[model samples]
Target chain A: MAGASFGYDPRRPVLRGIDMLVPRGRVVAIMGGSGCGKTTILRLVGGQLRPQEGSVRVDGQSVPDLGRDGLFALRRRIGMLFQFGALFTDMSVYENVAFPIREHTDLDESLIRDLVLMKLHAVGLRGAAQLYPNELSGGMARRVALARAIALDPTLVLYDEPFAGLDPISLGVVGQLIRQLNDALGITSVIVTHDVYESLKIVDYLYFVSAGRIVAHGTPDEVRRSTDPFVRQFVDGEPDGPVAFHYPARPYAEDFGIRAS
Target chain B: MTSVATGLRRVGAGTLRAIARVGFAARFFVAVVLQTPAALRRIQLTAREIYFAGVLSLVVIMVSGLFVGMVLGLQGYDVLVKYGAGDSLGIFVGLSLVRELGPVVAGLLFASRAGSAITAEIGLMKTTEQLSAMEMMAVDPLARIVAPRFWGGVIAMPLLAALFSAMGVFGAYLVGVRLIGVDDGTFWGNMQASIDFWPDITNGIVKSIVFGMAVSLIAVFEGYDAHPTAEGVSAATTRTVVGASLAILALDFVLTVFMFRGLGNT
Candidate 1:
């Protein structure tokens, strides 16, 4: 994406003049504080939302220009793992994994069965295929969702907050799976996350967003060594820096009538 | 003076918002209609929705229809006896059920039950990002999710109305003839003469179909437009019930006007 701008409300843009690139067959992370438009970028990339300005291009094709059919065709090549997995609660794990394949292809039930089981096995959830989404643990559900995302063998995979709420072990496992999947499938991966440590561990490059622009970006080592205050504050988990510790507001004394208005 | 101005402004704004909301809903309805042909390709999904929205509503409709018919029968018998027209009790019961009561009452019941359920289910799906997930998977949620439910409701409404009318007639028979000692032959003979298959039955079917489309459209549109939050889903579910019920009643009145305007002339 280049010079992409978007906002749910026109008066207040969430993402502004943004530019980013995901190299082929590499894992890249877009990280920022909460509400910094991280997820908006993912939506733009997935063709779920059109950028108000500039362009979001996936594989040399402009996304916003695509009609409904073109968009869906483009989406078939892009896999997105939403935050919280977003598994179909009504469907069994196996059916959820098989949904895209069934919707997009004419493969018979037997081949679909084999393909679904293979995807489940990769996520180590082959035995959980019969269970509904509500029956699975959070970690198990996320893994099932991961399996479903790759069901069509998409060339691009997007992960939105994949480690927001997970036990340490589960987090580590997910981090490992993300890295392994990208390499094993030869797919380009873009992960939007705030888990700096885990993300730095897995990602080949990082883009740190602040107030809707990429304030800093580089290799993990380069990012860690950067002297930029905002980057340093985020990387070191500091309490104060170029980013304020508190929201902009009126004076506390004036609000309490301690001073004349 | 300022307060008066503010009140007028608020009312004007509210009117405009209502119009916009209706426009939005109409567009959504058209989109779902356009997508229905594609949705039919997934016949099993539409069948499942019919089972959920139509088959599951059978018990309530059946019970309510029976009770409503019994009350109508008893009341009609009492009134007709005062006028020495007790033999025409079947005319009263059949006309009421076939023309107005069956379609309107069944529609109200359906709006409360199946329409609300569809809205809540879809709203929850939105809250959980399942709809978005489908979109990301190259599937149109409108085609995959909303269209099937819309068509299912439309197809089921007329059938459910017919069932309700049938049950209601049976209940009326039990009260008017077997219990009240009204002449059984007179009851059957009067009903047969009074209820025309086209004017009475067809109009009711048409009313139910229209009500079904209105209610289902409102339900799905509310769900699709719901904010992806717990409170938002709850609010959308409530709106679906209120909006669908009102739409059904309003549409019934308009349809009644049109249907009865040139009754004997037709």
Candidate 2:
């Protein structure tokens, strides 16, 4: 993505003049506080939303320029694990993993079954295939979603808050799996998250966003060692920083008539 | 003068919102229409939805049809007996069921039962991000999800209407012939003579089809456009019933005028 800007409502842009790159066979993390346009970047990468300015290019092709059919065609090469897993509740775990394969391929049931089981096995949930999404625990659902994301053997995988609601063990498992999967499958992975420590341990590089733009980006050690106040504030989880703790608003005292306006 | 300006502004804003809603609905209809051919390939999904939207609605429709027919029979018997034309009860009941009550009542019941369910289901799916997930997977949610349900509702409406009409005729028979002592031959004979195959029966089916399209489109569109929250899903489901019920009634009048009045002369 180059100089990409976007917003849900055109009058209030969320992401502004952001630029980033993800090299193949590497796990890159986009880290930010909530509502910092981390997920918006993933949306643009997946062609789910168009950038208001500049472009999101995947494989040297601009995303927003693609027509409907062209966009779907491009999307087939990409996989995304949404926040909360977003499993089809009506379908079983096995069916959830098999959905994209069935929709995009003419593979027979036997092959599809084998492929689904293999993907589930890779995520250590092969036995949970018969269960519904509602039956699975949060971590299990996220793992199943991870299995599904890699089912198509996509060239690029985007993870949105994969570690959000996971326990420490599950988080560690997911963080390791993300690193392992990218390396083993030779696929580029971009994870949007706020779990700074876990992400720093596994990611090849990190981009820390504040107010929709990247404030600092480097290898984990370099990011940690940087003296930039914004980066330092975020890295150390400080209460006060260049990014204010409070929203811009009217004065507290004047509203109570204790002081002149 | 300020009050007048405020009222005018409110009216203008309301009109613009209404226009925007109509435009959004039109676009949704077109998207569903275009995706229908692809949805056909996934017939099992559509069949399952038909069972939910159609087969599950059978009991309510059947019972309502029966009760409505019985009331019509009782009312018609009272009037016809006064006029010494008691045997014409079947003609009255049959004409009402085939020409108006069958399609309209079935449609209202369907909007309450099936249309509301469709909206809630889709709205919940949106809340859970399943639709967005499908889009990310390179599967058009309109083709996979909305179109199947749309076609399912369309296919189910006519069949349910037919069933309601048949049940209604039976209910009418039980009251008019067995209960009221109307001559059996006169009852059957008058109905056969009075109800035209082309104008009454076919036009009723046509009305059901149009109602089906309107209700299903409104249901799915509201669901698709709903805010992704619990309150949003609840509100969308409410709008589905209210909007579809109003659309069914309004469309019924327009269709009755066009199909019965204009076509009756020809």
Candidate 3:
């Protein structure tokens, strides 16, 4: 992505002159506070939304310029895991994993069944294939989603807050799976998350966004040693810093009617 | 004078908004129809929806039809007996049902049952981001989801309306022939002679098809346009029920005007 910027409303932009590049066969992380336009970047990359200005190119094809057919063709080569898995509730885990293949290909049912099981085994959930999405725990659902995402063996996978709302054990397992899958499949992975420690452990590079702009970015070692206050605050998990702890409001004392001392 | 002008402006703005919404819905309907071939290729999807929208509502429809027909039989008998023409009870009940009551009542029931369910299902899917997930997977939800349900309802509506009318005629039979002691042969003969296949029965079928399309379109459109939130989904479901019911009634009147213009001459 080069100088990519977008907003639902043009007047109040969510991302401003953003630029990002993910090298092939590497894991990159985009980290930021809540509502800091991290997910918007992922959407731009996925061609779900076109940037208002600038270019989003994946595999040398400009995404924003693609027509509907072109975009769908491009999307087939990419996989995305939304924040909460977004599994089709009415379908079983096996069916969810098989959906894309069924829609895009005409492979025999036997082959499709084998492929779905293989993907599920990779996610360590082959046994849970018959269960409905609502029957699984949150972490399991996310794993199912991950299995579904990589079922097609795409060259690029984008994960949006894959660690949100997971138990620590599940988070660590998910983080490990992400790294292992990236290395094993030789696919580039871009993760949008705020889980600093997990991201540092897995990612080859990091970009920290704040209020629609890249505030700080570096490798894990450099990010740890850097003196940038924004980076330090985020790293240390401070209560207040460049990103304020309190929302903007009128003076507390005045609002309570006891201002004068 | 200022207040009156402000009122006029408000009315004009409301009218324009209504027109814009109608235009959008028209475009959406076209898009849905364009995607229908793809939807039909996977016939199982539409078949499953037919089960949901049509087969599942059978109990309520049959029960309600029975009651409506029995009431008509009892009332028609009382009026006919006063005039000493009670033998025309079958024709009275059959014509009322096949011509008007069958499609209209069944459609109203379906709007509440199946139409609301479709809206709620789609709205919830949106709220949970399932539709977005489908899009990201290079699948058009309109083809995979909406079109199947639309065709399902269209196919199901006529069948359900037919079943309702059949059940209603039977109910009237039970009342007028067995209980009230009307002549069975006369009842059957009068009904067969009075209700023609082309104008009365076919017109009713056509009315039910139109109601089905109107209800299904409203349901799907409201679902697709709903805001992706819990409250928003609930509101969309409400809109589907209310909008479909109103559309069914209004379209029924308009269709009746055109289709039955020469009421007695036909």
Candidate 4:
């Protein structure tokens, strides 16, 4: 079958027309190595940037149909755990969690506090209420950003490299929280990351992007046996063979292999 | 593309873009005006900016004013004494301080200290993506960040300008009446009678407010738009300080011309 394609470019589709549906209450992982546009797909889906061709629809509204206010409201419905948590260093933990509620709603102080505490509790950070973002460990900061994300009870949550910088223990804790929260909150989840084995263990289904396209999609067992060269090489994380070195040569270099230095 | 077409488009877009950006700035000051009723609501941050703009600026304003007053006194005395109107030293120092020198000098001090700092702070925040985080979380950065500062500088400039005028008069009094051996009573009495409140003092207050808004607004705009890269941040910071300082000087000239024209007849 021809690879159906469209994405940031019209003439050359980023996704090659591949399609993957995210059900409302399941966790799906999109895995790809660095420079594979994994984060671009997430940004496209999350409305950070518009698809250059075709469309991205969140709950039937075209991404561009949303104005600033609409996009803000749409984003509030989707929690994002940005790389390294992206917590504002200026706000304390409680205030970070309370930020969305304060902006989007007119909840009274008591109600706002109650909601912030609940999200913090769910993330196992109820005790860190008064702490500033800088005071938290990597795992704790990610959890605080997670808590802030889920403060408004979003229907879908996007994790952009949630486990990128965590230690093994912290990674395990975060992986488990994603699973636990998925089950407990009944929220659809999309994780964009490169932590192959750990991500396979946590996710229900997998989509792999390569060269700005969704190269593979399946259950864990199906993807494990795939023969696609790029997919195989990526899953194996090999430094050589098949994938080949494609680094940018210097501007003055005459040919690809010539080492100008 | 034809050169003429490109040039025309550039000119057209540049004009519109500047107008829009200026409107963006005007909106910020308007927001500050709107929030004046709730001045007590955001008291802490406003007070912090005020203290930063005011108390920390005291030394610079005083020293600069003393020197400025002394220089203006000497220059005005020299020029007037050539006509044997040495008695007009009071008129020279008092009118210059109240009408022009006072506000511009205080604003220059502020443009250096507060203006550079505002630009750098906002530039750092921009490069770090903290400003984006604020927007995503629905923080009205203009209301929270820029507005307090614009108004704080506005209030601070006049207060500093008044202090400037006082010190300048004192400096002139020292240099003119004592050192130059002019009559003390005539100098003192002439200044009091010649200095009118409306066109001189009120005009200083008005220009300083405008100067304060321009300096703070340009600094924040340039800083908030600084790129994440270090080179961009440095460029933005430099641009902000230079741009704000130039803008203050230009506006002071324009306002002076229009102001004296309007008041000259009266």
Which scores better on lDDT, 3 or 4? 3
The better candidate by lDDT, 2 or 4, is 2
lDDT of 2 by residue, A66-166 (tens): 99899999889898998999999999999999999999999999999999999999999999999999999898999999999999999999999999988
Tens-digit lDDT track of model 4 for A4-121? 3345656655555546677779899988877677776766666666654566777677765678778877777788787777776767999989988877799999999999999999
**Regions of candidate 1 where Cα sits further than 4 Å from its true position:** B1-12
Worst 10 residues of 1 chain B by lDDT: B257-266
Q: How well is each residue in B103-176 modelled by candidate 4, as lDDT tens digits?
A: 88788788888887777777776665556555545455666666677667767778888899889999998899
Give chain B TM-scores in order.
0.95, 0.95, 0.94, 0.86
Residue B17 displacement in candidate 4 (angstroms) = 10
Per-residue alpha-carbon lDDT of model 2 for B1-266, expressed as tens digits?
99999999999999999999899889989989999888788899899989999999999999999988888888989998999889889888998898789998999999999999999999999999999999999999999999999999999998888889989988989999999888899999999988889888999999999888888888899899999999999999999999999999999999888887765443
* Candidate achieving higher TM-score, 3 or 4: 3
Clashing pairs in 1: none
Per model, kept true contacts as a fraction are 0.94, 0.82, 0.70, 0.09
Candidate 2 pairs with clashing backbones: none
A33 Cα displacement, candidate 1 (Å): 0.8
TM-score of chain B of 2: 0.95
lDDT of each: 0.92, 0.92, 0.94, 0.79
Q: Pick the winner on TM-score between candidates 1 and 3.
A: 1
